[model samples]
Target: MNLYQQAEYWLSAHKIDQLPEDEGIEVAFAGRSNAGKSSAINVITAQRSLARTSKTPGRTQQIIFFKLDESRRLVDLPGYGFAKVPLAVKQHWQKTLERYLQTRRSLRGLILMMDVRHPLTEFDQEMLNWCKLSNMPVHILLTKADKLSRGKGSAALEQVRSELSGEMSVQLFSALKRVGVDEARKRLNEWFQITG
Candidate 1:
């Protein structure tokens, strides 16, 4: 299926306390600030503005939810590891993210976007830790693949694989170039089918 064409805006929850009832499959998108999480969502949904893109860091503070044909939900979580953001806000996101990662059974998987230039930051490691503890399947997308040459992308991918000790799948992606979009979509679509 063409995932982009099937997505629709469903809901946005600022706090975990306000999240809707656990309904269908939820695949969360997370990464450090400026990691292209929002842009990736926009590309996957084929909606230019469905997920807000920002040059500034720490703008997305909510766990936004978008429905995919009523069978699965794509979540855009706030960017973590914004050193300039207030400590309170960081703490809040951390608590919420950790809790959601640890407890949400409906969360079928996680799409962890990372800038190819800086594949795995300390915060990325922490997020991986949470995924490990939860035993959640994760897919790491090295965003901005177009920024690097083909050889560079391959080397970066290898670097990340060697550095991260986990079971998550990895792919090099470029939202601008539409690279790896199909692979990411296929994985998410499979979760939708399983949940449906």
Candidate 2:
């Protein structure tokens, strides 16, 4: 079976203390609320409900883990920059996210999602900066690309690329239309060190 097909249940870490031992490769998905991060994960994994998708933003409040066999895992982090959430909760998540990114030994890469039409909000820039400091690889997914015309989508991709530096990869994706699904899967497989 393919790596994504082999993915199975892994523990959810509500707190840093609940995280699994730092022994395997993990690639995390992060984005602002309503950026379609969960939808992108579902599309990439070819699993409809692997990560819960909701119309409500900021519904994912915990760090959920999915294991592709024993040594490769995918992480779904809490969405940031949602205004409706309480300040204390948001602060807690921010602290936890910072700690995870800075100290997690097995984190090999990150998949940062952004809405195609609204790429690079303040939160997205903050994540890019953090990844830069850690020298961690990031793949930016401009989600909801189907909402735009082909020319517009291509233009958005180019615009975002021109603004970015370093080794980060960026692509236009539409989970609803299955756009860029294969490309996202291939990059994730490479990051997870999974062989076909």
Candidate 3:
């Protein structure tokens, strides 16, 4: 089976203490609320409901894990920068996320999703900066490409590329149109050391 088909929901963790033992490679998906992170996961995995997508932003409140096999997994992190959530909950998320990013031994890389029209927000930059400090690899997906003209989308991609320096990779993606799915799969496979 393909890597996507091998994915199965494994567990969810609301607190750092609840996380599974660090033993395998894990690539995490992260973004601001309503940035289409879940939708992108669904599209990439070819599992329409594997990661729940909601019209209401900030619905995902925990770190969700999907096992690809015994030693490879995908992590869906809680969406940050939601205004409506209570301050206490937001603080908890901030702490949990920071701890995970700083200490998770199995984490191989991060897939940072951003909407095509609104590529970088303050929170996105914060995430990028943290990854930079930690020397972690990040792949930015400019999602919702169907919302823009092809020329505009390409221009946005170029602009983001020029703005970022280092090992980061950026791509245009559209869950609606299935753009960049293969490239995403290839990167994920490489990160997880999955072989055909």
Error of 2 at 128 (Å): 0.5
lDDT of 2 by residue, 22-120 (tens): 988999999999899888878788888888889999978999999987888989999999999989999999999989999999999999999999999
**Structural similarity to truth (TM-score) of each candidate:** 0.92, 0.97, 0.97
Compare the candidates by lDDT and give the number of the best one.
3
Query: What range of 10 consecutive residues in model 3 has the weakest lDDT sum?
Result: 187-196
CA lDDT of 5 in candidate 2? 69
Candidate 3 Cα errors over 4 Å, as ranges: none
Query: Model 3 has how many clashing residue pairs?
Result: 0
Tens-place lDDT per residue, model 3, 5-61, is 778999999999999999989999999999998999898888989999999999789
lDDT, candidate 1, 89-157, per-residue tens: 888888897777777778888999999988888988987887788687888999999999999999999
Residue pair clashes in candidate 2: none
lDDT of 1 at 73: 86
Largest TM-score belongs to which candidate? 3
